[model samples]
Target chain A: MSTDDVDAWVESARRGDRTAFTKLFRAHRSLITAVVFRMLGPTGDLEDVVQEVFIQIHKSLPDFRGQAKFTTWAHRVAVNVVLMHRRRARSRPVLVEEEAGGHEPDAGLLPDQDLSRQRRVRAFYRLLDKLSDKKRAVFVLHELEGMAPADIATEVDCPVLTVRTRLFYARRELAQMMHDEPALAGLLAELELAAEGQEQAADADEPARTALGQGRDRRSDP
Target chain B: MTERESHDNIELRPSSEFSARAVRHVVAEVVAAPPPELDWARLETRLLERLESERVTLRSTPPGSLGALFGFVAMAASVVLFVLGAGGPAATRAAATDQLVDVATLPVIDDALGAHSHLAASLAPGSALESGGAARRFVLPGVAAFMLAPGSRVVVRRTGEPYVLELAFGQVTAEVVPRHDTDAIVEAFIVESGGTRVAVHGTVFSVARSPERVEVEVTEGVVAVGPAGYRGDTTGHLLAAPSRATFAARDARLIEVYAPTRATMAAAATPRRDPASLLPAANPLGISRLAEPDAEREVHVRAASRQAPSAPGRDVRAEAVPQPLQGNPGTDATSPPAAGGEPSAAGAVAMSVADARAAMVSCLRRATANAPAASLSVSVSSQITVTLDGDDDVATVQFAPPLRPEIQGQCAGLLFGRAVAGAGSSFVIPFSSR
Candidate 1:
């Protein structure tokens, strides 16, 4: 939605128009829900967190200076709420199921391709579980979300160097884990070979080379 | 062979598709999982209910209001009459005293008055009553009754032929029956608090008295509220039901009218509940479902593309084309320069790109010093665009992708303080971690 539309709805909602507020809720519910779900993972309190985000948005609307897009501001609020939930959860005991233990292959089937795929998927999440919340968020945004280190820095409110460092560590750790596991070793080698081929191909493509050079310049250390 | 053919010829291992398959799996399992069904209408109703409750909680009541003091006093006088032998047993007291209005049993009163379940409360012309920290209810048979809020003191007085109540503090809700007496003379019921008086014929209203003002809220009938002697004329305001009038003690000339909301009345009538206990519990298994691919998800897929060696140069266009900058919502085309001064040419700013970077490094180092290292990741390179005024003082520093407020504040403090050579120029300083 345009800024003007948001501003109008906000003004109306503040004046006690429930319909206008509902409109605002409808407009941004998806984005807020997605962020909350991603940050908390599938296990935590997704619905409560989303509701809390809206409640907070209503309370904080008066102070909103329109400094950022409504979605961006809402996204930040969701992130903060999730972080707080994480902190509170740490002080309390939580019952979490093992990531890989839940799914059993069909009873009569042999160890087939689908089972192998499911195993790999489970292993991926296991690796993700090893990182701290901050590193995990950074990795998810960069590697999974395809956000640049710079954009991830802005979203997570950290320095670009920090984002890069987390990404570097996350990738290194995942690679090590994959290599250590016999089932994942062959897949890891195959990915590594593809990566090598891609890098080599980048050297041959003129535009790719220029883009790579620019990427390097922008990525230079302070 | 064509490029596509050669690419197709390259042996595709099971693991070659591992990352793609894993991405799809995670997306399907978590990101794309369906959210629990929510009834928006029900949620909205609950939210509105809570908001109404909060509004009533925040509604301002006149301080030192007569409601509190009068209620207490009325209750106290009842106790005093019962203790003294002015009235016999509680049952007989109702018929004995001509001056006594009525006697009724109180279901709930302050713990102090717990022993006296039967309240033989009656106010004579000269009698005064005080209630402390407990609500008192009095039913005047065939005439009028009132519920006195806690901490009230009230004295009954005869101003001419009218029955006038002098409320010193706190609040009271009185329901007076209209005068239908066929007798020769009829007297008006007047509630006097602060410098204001509310005259009622037959109505249900609440009067609150504070040191600063007297407020009257009419719930069921009409009331004339104004300075004590202003006879229902230009000086007095006629208040209908569901309306309120406030008379300031400082300036008798000012009277404020208010329309009380239905929620406010309902809340006042209903007992207050602890707010925290009402919050709904979180649903642990309800992950949000994705209906369609979002911008962020697309970014995720594109990032995955770069990792696949088999898709070398498949579409480098996605990475090469910079996403359009999401401008600061606060900034506009007509916005003033960042330095809060006249816009200056970029060349006019004296600070070199290097100087700004150094400043940013210093600021960021300080800001992140106490923060956990793991929490300090910035995925994208941050571009801090500093605009300097004519005097070379930093006018404004805008972060391309906004950083946390603390970090932004730190950067602003460091860069704006220094005098640059070309004061008006804008310098884009990029901070990259790697």
Candidate 2:
């Protein structure tokens, strides 16, 4: 885990030492899998992406430079591999259940309805689905992952201004979804409550609060 | 009571804030270590063999420079054939002719129209008839749809439009848009496995059969699949939506729909055996036994949870899970092996989860294998509930026809799988059925 040990492993891995390469793969398998899963969706082929990432890491390791952190470089490599792999995936857009025409029928509701909180979150994602793929990436990285805008700009190869603009718009869109979709707004509130609960449990994890506090700084950019 | 009211509540709420938590969970899972003992030895051997054979060329010492000149002349002769698109004169024409045939076959489905019934035919727009099963690739491009009885397998070139497949008992993979849109053309693509009939609408999908399960995946648009009604449950459920995937158990239950990410896709080359969440909820329509007449039993019937309550009149009995086969045996529940005996908890869970997983895996594998032209249709008879162990999230769907089962199930699986594929064990628990 030390920097020195990490440096040696990188050098060894670049030389095609299977053992060294295996060590590196072991260290990052889960991280790579998570990234790939987020980029794709949770469902089928988690293992496929994991194996592919290792294979790609092996194939592309020779180009690694010490300029960036090993994790950063690996992420860069992983991003490309995921995007390419995504292309190879059948370009099918999973559809939502088509709404049946006419007034919403009053079907039976579950007797124990604890779904008040859950339904809202579902609507939020349904709205998030409307954002363009690029905007979505920016939003997910900056807001969800809490990656600094600069880091996102670097990863996505765009200007920081563009990242900021995307974030601004993304928030606006999310906010608008709140206004336009009452169900979504309630869900957002529930989400905030859930997040607050988690925060009270682990004060360390609520980066969103800090991110929110920095709203002034973001606004000052314009 | 109304979607509008649902919207009203959502508007008053805060934004969904599990992003960071979800991401962190994903990070922890992704960064975990691989198991100590994998078939590394075999993988290494394979890699070495490939390197030795492909990277290292055999070098021979010619008898002086004169022999070298002769070698160059022989090399030129070989080069001419390759450069001319063939290794030899006959090979060149054959290759060209095959290309021509493939090109002529441009759209695979058009030819399938009016083709003889019960007879498997090539649908590839322009591919040549090489020989044997290789020729089966052509069947995908031509047919609009076809029917299959138990024990049938068909291969077709990838296409676009969904083809209807009737599965009495067997497996078939149709081509989707493979590297090109023109690759998919055909209409009726049918594979009937265990009385379930799946029709490909406008998506690229595939289906595989085992004795107990039938797997389906939508590589492109969503595919609609339902039970062909061989026995136990006649109603079929939509497996997956566009880009989503699902598997169908022979008991005729549709398992979770999963969306493959880049990583999982890369990791899995063959059908996966990982345990999956349960299928879509069973349809409550026309239940022979129920506690109430309008119990909305369809919604609960397909519920994935073991605790999912059963219909009123139908006696809900707890049964043990069935013993898992050595690996996944794609069995549809209704094909001959009647449910006369009691299943152990281990057996029931294994069967439920395995069958569901197989349906999804088979769907995906077949899509990659066969891209058929024509629109795929999906109709579900009930609601579906997906619950994950160790995770608070449970995806529940109570909606109408053309259900996007793939997306629903995939999201549920991914959400849970991301957090629990390794350390935390999970299974799709089916409720006790009468």
Candidate 3:
């Protein structure tokens, strides 16, 4: 659907049109679920929180003045729901619940690959829980959600400089935590090796690309 | 994919340093999980049903005559109670300040708690059901969790207000949910023992109380211990996490504290001292047990003292006495170091555990400021056991659950090799963000 169609559907949904509301829900469901999943980390309450987000969106739909994009509004709604969910429960959930597996889509993930990925993800979240809420939100939006600092500042309602500063400190804190966590030793070693391998690959490819750019011959003088 | 917002693959990028390379990988894995494939039709149905039900409830419960009458009657009763009771703000504050406490830490919670009439029976564990209290754990769900010792008894009272649990005798470790300043139940949960009441917010702490004295040790968060009814958020000495304070149970006077740099921090900014930091008062690392005759007392504290005398007139210098650890137990608790061939602590300066802790805190604060990429804004918990060798007064720091071998070197660099006090005594300091 084009922008016009979305805007029309939003208008109808604002006016309580069931079909229009359903269409909008289906349209934004993926974005909403992805955000809620990442923000809440692999806890199993993604469904309820998503439902709460839609409900909240429906309730506050009239107040949304189209100042931001529909997805941005939906993202903010999801963030707010996650915040409320944590505040109400005050429970620090770990990935033990996900250890049984089968929750993530297994389309292409190999068995060993899946387990290591899960372990790394779990460790990251456990450390992530230590961050204060404000810093955590800003970090997630920028680092995980792939948002630019300026965009994050707009989303989190903070100054751009503030967002950049938070991101800088958040990265540093996370790096130190990764080093300090004893359980992640083996994983940390693997990551460093992988980094070294990637750097070597890039180094090998760089000369060939440079030679091509300069129209140089392949054979050396020797 | 949208205008102005680019969902770039920033998370998959490598960090700037080798030590932190794991952060990029873990974060990448976390966000890599595909958006779940849910039965969209079913999910939408459930969501619509919930919304409809809420709407119906709101429509059905439109305030009517009966609701108005109930509200009026409750308001009138509240007004009468307010006027009839002490017609002062002090009384009102007292009512609002009523605290909620976990009885699991109370020793006399069994049958001898009657003399203390304020001990609300409602919170007495297994009281009404008369269920045998055979060492059961009482959980306050999300708020707090307590482990009952072998012979101890406890009852959970889940109320919305704050409380005071008078600790006649007992030892208990509790991890409480972090509370905010804006909570509806704004009053702090108080644990009252002999002569002091320890008020705490969100923190993990352990309290041990005897008829004669009480000791409160905080492993996380800040706590305030003052006389039984000291109302000073400002005046009460603050004890930051990983420190312990001993008070006379009857007199409730603060005898000694093993807190790090609290006095210096508070002295520097007495008015502006973050109530969140340890209190401004000097923490003279003192454990009443240090004076006991027990040969197995293991007192672990963060090392590094500024050499500032913790307390006036209490210049308890480090005697050449060997307070050897349990493995190498010294004969007399106070006997001179010449009692045996064990390495005498003669040359070791008397250093308190707080000295090293202060040094670490100061060093870390600088480390964060100096290293742009090494700053710490979040709380990180790492416990280090430093043994005062007295040989060179150079303490050996051991990090439990150990850091990466290379990074361990970095942690030591943060300490700057400052001399640790409390010669011959092992001190375990749990470090965190100030």
Candidate 4:
């Protein structure tokens, strides 16, 4: 949506227009839920946090200056809320349940393929949990969201070099963790073959070939 | 082989699909998870309910009649007369020079003063005042007027010196009347928060004490702010109007001064009804007491003022009275229709770039109407790449050149899991704030 559209709704909401505010909430709810979910994982109180975020947004809407996009400002609020949640959780002790045993492979897939992928994914999150907040945020933005270091830097309010350094460390740690797990090792082998197959497929398509070349060029840069 | 050797032997290409799969899993488990179904109607009802409650709280009347006002004024007059009549000439002189500030307006909260419910009493040195639920306004006649935010605790330090307000917690906004003469009676007013001290003579500012830092925002005049002990020393920074500074709780010496954003100035300028006007007219003896229950009196006064003939000078006051939000409360179906024709079950008709840009701009403008015009002046150009799911809902939103840190979170939050009106597809559109 255009900035003007967002601004008008903000104005309407500020004026106590419930419909406008609801529109704003509906428009941004998914994004906030996703970010919060990614940052804090699928906790039971996810909806509560989302509600708090919207309430805060409503309270603070009057002060929003449009210095940045509405979404950007809301994102900052979500991040701060996540950090605060972490802080509060740290102050008090809570019981954490151990992970349930691995799921059995469905009828279609090979037992190793299904179990290994699930295990690798679980192990990935575990490794991510070990990283510091800044590093994890940088890594998630860059690797998961397909954002560049500079973009991650902008989002996290850090220098590009810092983002790159954090991503590097996050990747190194995750790689080490994966190397230690035999299932993850097998998953890696499968992913490498899949990527190679896709690369060959892309070579046959002219646009994809160009995009792949451009991607290579970007990665090759300092 | 050593652990380092094994690590070196392993191929760890950062961009390999293994990393991709891990990221995909994380996304699937978190970002792509089905959000809990929100009962929008119920949520809206609850929100409106909360808003109504706040409005009522903010507009309620104090529990007393005009008789209470008269009785309070009579009692205060009797006390003054007793003091003057009983005091000898020398004692009367000392009493006249006493620098006690009066409570201009009692907060609406039930527990404003803890055990002491009455704010009709003057605030003396060494006296501490605490407020809950509602903000209390105190006036040092001709010196300053300060409103303490809810849940704030402030202490009036010893007299015969620069008036010192020790803030233990919460926020306070002070409007210090300028002293024209160099030898004014009140030499200075200082707000002490944590280890940071803000010294002022004539200024409108706010000081908020948070867990990690003390934030000072100056709106009108200059102030000297620094470590609490550096009273006359040059250890602190001089902050001018339209600026803010934060002092860390752990380190007094470290102060971060930031240029005031549009939001800062707007917050500092939030209109407050004059507490004196909310009270009944001053008594014949010129003593004004807190009589009105809540802000309802202010609203009545506003309604009365609106009925008066529109004198040329009254325009400013009319502008000052905040307008209630426009729109009927019951209407819920106000979402604007999509510009293009309705989407078929198979797929939405692709929106032309120009049409899409116009639609987006209109939406954004509506969303940010209340934002400061100056901050909105800069044209923001963005390229939004939207990936749609099979149902035509938005699965992802990516901005080119990346969004600013402040905007990214909101964009991600609102765009990631939304369903747009179209079949599964990926498209990029450029939008500009003009």
After superposition, which runs of candidate 3 have C-alpha atoms over 4 Å from their true positions? A1-5, A89-102, A154-157, A180-184, A194-222, B1-16, B39-42, B61-434
i-RMS for every candidate: 19.0, 16.0, 11.4, 15.3
- Please identify which of the two predictions, 1 or 3, would achieve the higher TM-score against the true structure: 3
Q: For residue B348, give model 2's deviation from the true position in Å.
A: 56
Pick the winner on DockQ between candidates 1 and 4.
4
Q: Model 1, residue B197: displacement in angstroms?
A: 46
- Pitting candidate 3 against candidate 4, the one with the higher DockQ is 3
- Residue-level lDDT tens digits of model 3 in A29-80: 9888888888877655667668778977997899889888887887888877
Task: Report the number of the highest-DockQ candidate.
Answer: 3
Interface quality of candidate 2 as DockQ: 0.03
lDDT of 4 by residue, B79-185 (tens): 11000011112211111223433343543222212222233225666566655566555555444445555555555653334556654344444444444344222
Give fnat, all candidates: 0.04, 0.01, 0.35, 0.10
Candidate 4: Cα lDDT at B83: 4
C-alpha DockQ for predicted model 3: 0.19
Candidate 1 regions exceeding 4 Å error are A1-4, A96-126, A144-158, A177-222, B1-434
Q: What is the DockQ of the complex in model 1?
A: 0.03
For candidate 3, write residues B1-434 as lDDT tens digits.
64223423234222556645566667667777785676677789987776664443233222321111000000000000000000112211111222435444333322121211122334542121111243233333323333333333222222434433322112223333344334222333333322345554333344454334455554333444444322223113334333455555533455555332222222212222222222112221122222322111212222323223234444335432222222231332221122122311221234345655654555444443433245544444456656443432433344443322222222332222223444454566676653
Best by TM-score: 3
TM-scores across all candidates? 0.33, 0.33, 0.40, 0.35
> How far out, in Å, is residue B396 in model 1?
45
Model 1, span B127-241: residue lDDT tens: 4444556655553433434444455544465433344555434444444434434311133444553334444423334454344545554433334444442222212334333
